[model samples]
Target: MTHVSGKRLSVALAVAAVLATACTGGGAAPKDAAGGYSAQPKQTGTPKDGGTATVALTPGLSPNYIYPYPPAAANGTVVARGLLWRSLYRPSGEGDQIADAELSLAEPPAYSPDRKTVTIKMKDYKWSNGSPVTADDVVFSMALLKAALAESPANWSFYTPGQFPDGVTAEAAVPDTLTLRLETAYNPSYLLSMLTLLYVMPSAEWNIARTGGPHLDYKQPKHAKAIYKYLTKESESQSTFASNPLWKVVNGPYLLKSFDSTTGSFSLTPNPAYSGPGESRLDQVDFKAFTSAAAVLNQFKAGNLTVGTLDSSFVSQIAALKAKGYNVYGAPAPARLDSLVINFKNTVNNFDKIITQRYARQALQRLIDQQGYITSRGVYNGAGSPNYSTAGHGSPYPPAFGDRPPYPYDPAAAEKLLTDNGWKVTPNGSTTCERPGTGPGQCGAGIPRGQTISFTLASANAPAFVGARDVAFASAAKKLGIEVKIVTKSLNYMYANYGNTYAPATKNEWAMQDYGPLYLAAGYPSSNTVLNTEGSFNLGSYQNAAIDKLINASTFGSDGKSLSAEVSSLAEDLPVLFLPTPHTLVVWKNTLSGPQSSFNALISFLYTPELWYFHDASGARP
Candidate 1:
């Protein structure tokens, strides 16, 4: 979970073109500026490489583990594993949408007619230590991942029951090919999507035996457990990252050079043995941590940093930064969304009755002035739009769902819906259920007479913007005869109370939750993990047999029609109140050129630093 940078503020509307010119080097303007921006400058001459690019890292945001699988901290996943690791398929193109999968460590997979088996052809790549990255490595990595999942189910939430490395059997068919035979028929597209994020590890480094033997057999529960325990200890050795022999066998584009725990800073040098597209153009890259956005902006102002992001609070200062020849761009944050998730399982105070009511949920959605919320919150210059579908607006599947508005902001409509639903409204205050029944147009089953339409709404404590929005939501709800009491909690605490797998609703404690942007994994847009009855992220425990069917169909649904149908169904269900997609503000020096400045999924952004480069000898704009 990531925090909103700061108070939301809109960028100047007039500077859109300037920002485009600076970030894209006068290229065609982005179709949706808020969705994402490019830092790739249009060049007039040949690229000159060899310089250091300094970046500002958010303070206190450090990766606890550098490995990708078995889940590490978000920061660590984004900065450490994201940069140091390479997956079989890479996320490409702009926005959070699952762009075309770029071949990385493997070629396109070959699937059996039944779609139960897949054959992957590995690329002829080499690890930093000069060892060939072959099918054995891929198979071994899968075994380790499977072992890790079995040992720590909490970390691998994406793996469904009896799936990959569990239900599927893996074998090295050839020196360069690995075959996976699934025990059950599954969606090939979804399987491919999942593979795009898998970080293949070096088998030699990770398959060690803890008990005086050869490499531990991942197939054996005892050996797998021992290997998992050993890796866990290595992963937590934050102070020994640079010296860890196990981490030194990376196959990605950069090698860790040094780390300073005191400053939360690290530096990377291009991996000389890296065999991938867009070889490093810079000699080294330095990531420096800053306590606040102000400090980052100050460093940029002092010309001490080459690239960093500006919080919404700093959107107003873009003009000044551009005046100083810095390039600023608005990119859509990858998979990030702010939403009001209702707890359907909550039985405390009979809040479940009101929350479970479709009309009540629709009324609440309508009461929200999405446009006004974006404006006052001050981010992206109104680049935000009302999101109605479960998938984000930038998600590839939303367009297939077609443009549909289920509930427009109509306070009168909201009020009437409540009144018509048997909720009695006092002239200047909250409402009470006067007609509670199991029939249509009534506050569904279990609602008692005289029950007030009141519940607690909680937001994260940081990112003043979310709290501000919470207050605004409460104010609007109150005006329409709904009582919404706002409370603040730390992000961790909020998630503990409302996260998937574990939620306060188990004790019937929470009603509504508001927090930072929730990012979907790259390559596929499926809310199954967040919406399905058995979904790991199903915080509210919202269950619908019909919705479940749609989600299941979408998983392997072959055509655009199936995906469209699923998204369309979700848009009407109003499972969660979708909020605006916040603009990702990028601030960078004009000299840097490459894909690093362009919009890719957030996960890809942190991992592909090799694509960044200096345009000239002096690292100055040509």
Candidate 2:
């Protein structure tokens, strides 16, 4: 589902829009018969034979410091990768687009009956520079990814723990075809999903290993490990993203042609020699970045861009747009659940002692009144469904999350949790559990008894984050006798140097923070990218033997009824404190179309722009 941020529109999907009563901005589109958006499609007359779609861009609205680390790129990502980087055997509307459904490799990857060692035959496939994307690309990608991890082991640890073969740099397997030998039996599905991040850089072109040049010269056969660490430091800092030729390699359907750092704007075109079936519809997209919510809305009004909603409190303004027939269409956003995690890492910050308690996390969850945030706040505005599952509250895959009851949104239960834990209520409504909860008087001797436990919270503060998040949390926490100080920062600021704040010694400043899972795809009950300490997205650093085992089972185990139940059991215990994961609105010039069908709740909006062609000046949907 797509969304207009300001006013929540129930975007009903349709082909063409009818005539409008007037010409203006700030309104909602009249809902059509099928319950989709019906509007007079913005007319871009004199449509050329296809030049460039500048994509009035917002380059960094996602606020990520990195360019493409499974990080969200505004129009840039969709334009560049979607057009430039075409994966081998990638997903499509009907079937696998890159490779035939019949797994026809030379010998169909020599599998060791146990399915651990996959000997892939890279007879077909070529990179932008015309080099065959061999097993070496795969091996190189895995090795570089491993080296990429070694750069900052903690940050990249979640995806592949112990992925690096010890001193096997010479044997890291850069060759014509990849013969991946796993220590344990890995599921076929896990190997396929790994493709989401498996960007095979041309061995000679992608230099994550060599020192200078746009991308670190990863082609340097020897220093494969050292260069990855250096390149990652550059990647995280958005260092030289524009200058890197390695970054421009074609893997998907698009490639980055030009990017402007100041405007946060960029343009991309279809690769000429690219071996792919799909070609981009709009050759150019003018992307215009906006700093504040006001700037985003203002651009929409001026007709510089096409789509938008009242993400800010301009609820009334959104109504006005409908009156004038702006054909405003919107969806809340893709369904996601926002959550909070008490960083288990060592820290002297406030709440370090309190957060360690599992019950303490549960207690905080109960106090937060997640229901109110879901219902009253209208955070999703209207397009989204409130969620309670990692797989989502309701239907999708195999229904991993049974239709169980939502978490207890009871404040009273929260209070009992605090009181029963020996937290005494002071004159000022706040409660304080004795240090260590039950320690010698010395545990209480050093720290103040009634100083009111100070809790620090940090969040991305993205558009959806601004007002909806911290406010409700602050209000809920205070009622339960906790003094929480909210720290709102930019997305770029938070994912500094490495995906974490500066460091525990110099930068980490929160007891709990708004957490966005570094997870790439959405799945049933299991997740390595979710639970693996080696993944870039597993931000919370949560660890439990039972939880880890179940997640592994979910990832590698068969997708079955029993596996589904395990995920539900984990959620009940609040693996991470559940909060409302709100929807993200994609606002474009009304001229933009053909994106919704490509939405894969698992991947970003970068999937199918090749099929994303536009209508003639006649403004036809087809």
Candidate 3:
């Protein structure tokens, strides 16, 4: 983890950058201006690099894959991206996680230059099959992420399709490079994020035409969106992407050699012929897995933790590690934010899902107390501030920071909003909806005057979520006039089929749900992925055009636009709110220093393993 530097220049620069984000619509960062570091990285680092750096992280598994292609926190994907894959473009250490941020891909043509198109040249690289990595691969991947069902069938950040308000079309404009044509001015980093954000299927591995395989053209409108589904869903699962020549079609420094599916452990070694910037410095990287985080510290003490994330409880141990002359690092978190996400597109009968009411759900923003929550958890280095509402809009940009007004805490206002909307609060505060006095047929006078709503909730087995957030909200709702019953189950079952009835998936069990999206980055629950009404990441399905428009405008301005001024001001009103910023302290030997690089900020909890180098990190570069 990067240590908190009090250098006035760096702090001033940091303030100016985040202030640019806060005032992006033109607001200023917090009063201190120098305290712009985000309190917690909601996500972890996937920043590009190699070497084994064991650390403690929470929710360390993916949906089920070796790559972040499907995005499971605990899965092999995060690790895989770090050592094996590359994004079209990379972020400049701003924003938190995959949604709503800048990019590292080929920059768009400068408008002043009057250039309508930008051509990206690929390095002289090839798939593991030895096929040259070309513009088509990028085009293919971009098209896949853009297709309408990108989220449902393919990659995790599905709403990116709409990101191109004017839209962009990629083609093999050049033999060795791709030519991207955007209708309006766009950020290269945003588009590059797709290539950087997702695990790219090898044209060779997927048996693509360019790989001496199939002649399939994903460019066809009909086949574009489904291309993502093909590589991810159609192919058989691999035991090791490195060992299998078929799956080894990548361009990174390391390759997978062995894996243990049952234990989720895997190993990697240098790829003799990788085409990226770094050279392998270690003999090999061994990834060990455990079901509980508590065991991570003990393992690290025994020299088993290749990388480490400090849990609040292990703060003393971390100090001990530092005192013992080990490399102890407190890296500055990159792209991370934690959120209590809800999927509103959920089925009416989907009891496993939570949050059906729009205003009621938005009301959650005010009800949460972030400071109190973070205090309760207690595992941070105290360098970052609460993103509170959105990430990067303040401390990340410039000018001593710019942001919206504060989101106030008002339980009474929250209850009143629910009450004025035909809800009747029982003495105990369990609310029941009064039949609509007038409006749609079902909610109109046609229905009974008032009715009570009672249901059970289904939750994934994540301790922080199920044990803390969900339970607390359930109790709080009782005060607002609703009965919420809690049910717990394995994370796999809860994530994929919680919305389905218990009789079939779980069989004969019925319940409502109140679970959040597993955020590796500490993110706000109001971006395209989490809140866009038509966007894929809007899992909770809570739709409000006003909020959506505000979010859209905010994200556009925040990403690389001049619109920060407006968005920062709007966010002050509040969108989605978590009472506390979740944190996990990381302790390493004092031998660590410089930038804690990694695949990206998705692994911020571990403080970016790739960047971990001895304090005298000068000669270690490849």
Candidate 4:
């Protein structure tokens, strides 16, 4: 998943614009004259065969784990996995499709009439060791994946109790064909979306539990568990990443040439025996890591970096980079939503009861000034769009309240709603519940009179926007006498130690949290393991029977419209306080040329650097 940033329910707030422009050097970016920022660079020339490209890893999100399916504590950072081991189906950069047919290792799956079994035909691909990549490898990967999930749902974010690897069985019945038998039927579209995340590893080379040990059948449950344990342990030794024989075996375009445990930087070289779509033209890729975005901007200024993303806070530097011979383009991170996730289990100040009330939730949502947040120079700097639904902006499955929020930002309305619901509205003072009962106009059940709307908000320190927006939210809430106490924490710390289910002891410590963005699969964007009642990633215990039913319908039913209904319901429900969706500004050297599809930022941050090449004096177009 990708982590990536509304408010008045209207009014183009002129002062915010003035302040935004003043902070950003007056012009956020130069006009395209030709249209706007294009994902693909417009270069006219042949690409040079050998040259190293220095890429910048997202600030605070460097590759700490080389293995696919990292533990929950890893904070879901994946930059090297795609380059080392390709998934069975390559993600189609386009929003219209789930997987790219031409680049996939396997052909489009054929489903049985009963829609319970799927047969997959593998393409001719080979591992770095020159061995043919077969369906056996796919089965091996699935086996290890199930083993990982069996250990803990926190092992994989996409995991749900009875989903994907749970009741499904895989078999490689033929040399190049793999068949899967499912215990239950699922929507084909949703199933295809899940498959895009399944990366294939070499079974013959990586089927051992220890170094110099004999290989075992990965299909066996016990053996698979041992193998998974071994690989995960090996992955922990970051210092030996380049020397590890287990990490060297790959079917994708590049190989791990070296890794820097100290700085989290690494380099990749083309695998000589790789059998994939791209030319693998670049001689090497140096993924540089940084502690902050400002350092990356400095590297760009010095021409020390070739490819990287510009933080929203640094959008003002776009024109300066363009002058330095760079192609800069940006779009909202695809299938991503940034929100202030509420901890429904937090009993502090009776927050659970207050938040559980639909009116209370609506009042809290209205207090958020989305427009003001995005327009703030310290925040998104006009690099984001207002999104009220989990479906995000430009989603194929849009809520009924298209563009307009169900509860718009109006402090007066927010105060009125609270007052109507047994609250005594005291501007800039503690507003307490005057009436407490299950009846209408009363602060729902379990809430007692004199209960105040005060809760602690845990905010992530990275991304800048999370803290900026939280401060803005707290400020807005103060006007309505809703006390919002914010506590800042590192992203990794929050990911590892701040969940209701995973960290029950601290469940009451945080009433709400803003941990940047959560990315879903590219095309489908299912909320299955995220919003579901039993979802492992459901940080807060938000259990709604109606939402559960809607999720099930979208997940299992044949009708795709159910997703729209589900998202619309979620938008109105305010499970989490929706924030503005921010754009991920991708910047690369002008000399780099590749297919336009390679740079699709929307599709799970898709980037095919293997297909890119330098088109300079030595390698000019014909």
Which candidate number has the best lDDT? 4
- Model 4 stretches astray by more than 4 angstroms: 1-40, 73-79, 617-622
Tell me each candidate's TM-score: 0.87, 0.73, 0.70, 0.92
Q: What lDDT does model 3 reach? A: 0.44
Q: Provide the RMSD of all predictions against the true structure, rounded to 1 decimal.
A: 6.4, 9.2, 8.4, 6.9
Arranged by TM-score with the best first, the candidates are 4, 1, 2, 3
Identify the superior model by TM-score, candidate 1 or candidate 2: 1
Writing each residue's lDDT as its tens digit, candidate 1 over 337-409 gives: 4678878876767888778888888888888776676666343344445555654444444433344467767
Model 2 poorest 10 in a row by lDDT: 6-15
Question: After superposition, which runs of candidate 1 have C-alpha atoms over 4 Å from their true positions?
Answer: 1-40, 43-45, 58-60, 70-79, 93-103, 209-213, 333-336, 377-381, 399-401, 462-464, 503-509, 596-606, 617-622
Per-residue CA lDDT of candidate 3, range 1-622, in tens?
1111100000011123433334322222222111222232222322324345443434445213543354222222344553555455433343433322222223322222333466666557655555666677777666655553434321343343455422667768675766667665443333333333433445435534222545566777556544445554422365544454544666555677776666656676767776544445454666666665567766766765645554443444644654454443333233233445443443333322224444555555656544444334332323223544344332332212333335445778877765666667674654656745554322223224555544455665654433565666566667666666678766555544432211124322434344433332222223444445555444344466776665565444334432233234325433344433333334444433334334234334322233343332443412
Q: Identify the candidate with maximal TM-score.
A: 4
Expressed as tens digits, the lDDT of each residue in 1-622 for candidate 2 is 1111111110000101221111111112222222233232343434333533333233234222322332221111222432444433342221112122221112234557876666666546556666655665555565665554454443332344544232223223545556666666554544443443344555556554445545544545346666555544555434355567656665545566565655445555665555554456567544455666666666656655543434523333454544433344433222234467556553543454556565667777776654455445334343333445554322122223333333556777766666666566442366765543255322232334554556667766665644465677777777766777887776555554112321444224656666343222322223454544433345445566776666666455543333344446556666667665443333443334443434321122333445445545555431
- Please give me the total number of clashing residue pairs in predicted model 3: 131
Residue 523 error, candidate 2, Å: 3.6
Q: What TM-score does candidate 2 reach?
A: 0.73
lDDT over C-alpha atoms for residue 205 of model 2:
64
